[model samples]
Target: MLLRLPTSVSEARECLAEGAVPIGGATLLWAEWQRDGFPALAMSLRGVPEAGVLGRDALGAAVVLHRIDDRVPDVLRLAAASVGTGAVRRTATVGGNLVGSTLRCLLPAALVLEARASVLGPDGVRETDLSEVTAKRPLLLGLRWREPVASAYRKLSAAPGGRPPLTVSVALHADTAGPRRLRVAVRDGYEVIDGGAPHDGDPDTALHTLRQTALRDLPEAAWDAVAAQVAVVLRAADDV
Candidate 1:
């Protein structure tokens, strides 16, 4: 495979517009590509000077992942759970995991935190919410997020190998002009959050369903209790 390392975001954009597949850290892509060849041209973004920095934005309310920095602890924890094993964690790029259509717990966490993306595309530099960009596009340049009121991620796996989680849930608590914003996302099959609607039910009902759906391996009643416990903790945190 041929690789090109662009030093700046503009260079990366130019290459992408010319039909080059942008790769960050190359952890996820390499695994899938090695098993099944993809036709697109490849570029390794690892050498780019800006590929690895994590910084807070001017307001100091959010976290931004630049191209040059290693994945943050929270991000690593999320990725480690997804693929399992230390080897995958080392190679998987936060950007790569987001690019995949599969529902990752972190994406919603970023959304709950009010994260945005700074994308350098052929048209020019554009900023959009990370959730919106990931849903609409196949690629991502970077991710940014504002300070979250509260956030939590939970996943359920059936076997010991830590295989892909059977179900995952992420909750973000934010204060809005209206009611306190409680955004909950559940990943099951290709559908995330049962048609992508935010939970509008009572906290008990919402938590019950989330846990039951996410932890298929566990008994419904048991998981429901667990879900209730999580909801209580999250709600309490939000209150504080």
Candidate 2:
């Protein structure tokens, strides 16, 4: 097996240009590799910087879960908390959590936060939306985004204790004059954009509409319960 460790972002990008499959944390990737013989070329991203919670929080993808808990916003914190246990978090990286996408709890939170990520490939370093990266990837060097006024993440597990979570996240953009940006990201990425707040035009109307627009496909029996839970997510943000 060919292995490369690039410490800097530029070096990481160079490795990708050569067709190396980038490995972030590899909590899952490594497992797959072990199961199906290792790949020809594997680039380890651990050498890059991926921790910090100040200013936009540089959050290098290599930073572990414990650091994520220390620096990221509440929504991200909650998502990180749900990843595994303290031991797992100590080894898990944000990029790893993100790659899990629906398999983990952080993707929805990252979307709700409208986080921005830097993907490096042969072309160059380009800034892309969080949701956009969810569908594609090359290498995630860093993630940056401003902290929201208030944000929350929720999960509906398949059972009492489960590894994968049916996750949902809500983020409120605090702007008094302009239309509110109420970002919500479900497990499969049901997103609701800008809308009036409970006070602006109608009380809970936007929230209710969000529930409808995002959860319209649910069966009649589960609709109300899901909506109620979504309401709790919205209310939780407002209560903060």
* Residue lDDT tens for model 2, 89-123: 88777777775534645676776666789877678
Each model's lDDT comes to: 0.51, 0.64
Q: How many pairs of residues collide in each model?
A: 10, 1
Clashing pairs in 2: 50-60
Across 152-205, the per-residue lDDT of candidate 1 in tens digits comes to: 555555565544444433444444553344444445444444211134436665
Task: State which candidate has the highest lDDT.
Answer: 2
**TM-score between candidate 1 and the true structure:** 0.66
Q: Where is model 1 more than 4 Å wrong at Cα?
A: 31-41, 47-51, 55-82, 101-105, 130-132, 159-164, 176-178, 194-226, 229-240
